[model samples]
Target: MPVGEEVREAWRADLDPKIQAVRRLARRYGARLLAADGMFAALSATARPEHWSADGVHLTPAGHAALAAAWLRLVA
Candidate 1:
């Protein structure tokens, strides 16, 4: 089942700050941050809805592949 908008919003409110903190710390430490959230957001904006799972919290197979590709681009 799909998650409710309220739950989704709550999760974002809780997690977004932590993600930003990690990104900031990674930059401070001269470490590479994968920017997975950004990648996912971009994909969600441009790609078809099938990339995400029914619950909207997890990724489907294509989404995982896309994330892997993004990671490869950052690492390679």
Candidate 2:
């Protein structure tokens, strides 16, 4: 199963660096990445195993498409 938010919350001190890496990727791509308290809260509440694979990780093709669409909407 994907690690639940409860467990993730317990390890946030460790997880932050990894999340920062995502921010770094956004910078490398010249993408605007905005992190907010509400974004984290919503993600914690709505993140699902279905978002990924049997290993409960990585974006599926549809996930990539959705991300692309969101970026398009923001940029356009």
Candidate 3:
């Protein structure tokens, strides 16, 4: 989990600015951005062991289902 946390820290450091830029552009253009990364981060916060595969990075079936549900909630 520590490794996952480290990776998330690095990922946010690199991506948060880019996501912010995209958010600005989306706001300007009246467009939408579906940020799956943020969705996954939220899921990971409450993740069960079955949520991840052996590799940890990849999602298991249950995880994929959960993510899909989250996406639907965002879009719906």
- The top-ranked prediction according to TM-score is 1
lDDT of model 3, residue 2: 31
Q: Which candidate wins on lDDT?
A: 1
What's the TM-score of every candidate structure?
A: 0.84, 0.41, 0.56
Tell me the tens digit of each residue's lDDT in model 2 across 1-76.
5667676576676767878888899999987775532343454356654553223345566555655666677678
* Candidates in descending TM-score order: 1, 3, 2
For every candidate in turn, the CA RMSD to the true structure comes to: 1.7, 5.2, 3.4
Selected candidate, larger TM-score, 1 vs 3: 1
lDDT of 3 by residue, 1-76 (tens): 3347677588679888998999899899988667766666576678754364434567778767876787788678
Residue 4 in candidate 2, Cα distance off native in Å? 3.8
Q: Rank the candidates by lDDT, best first.
A: 1, 3, 2
Each candidate's number of clashing pairs is: 0, 0, 0
**lDDT, model 1:** 0.80
In model 2, how large is the Cα lDDT of residue 47?
A: 61
In model 3, what is the error at residue 37, expressed in angstroms?
A: 2.9
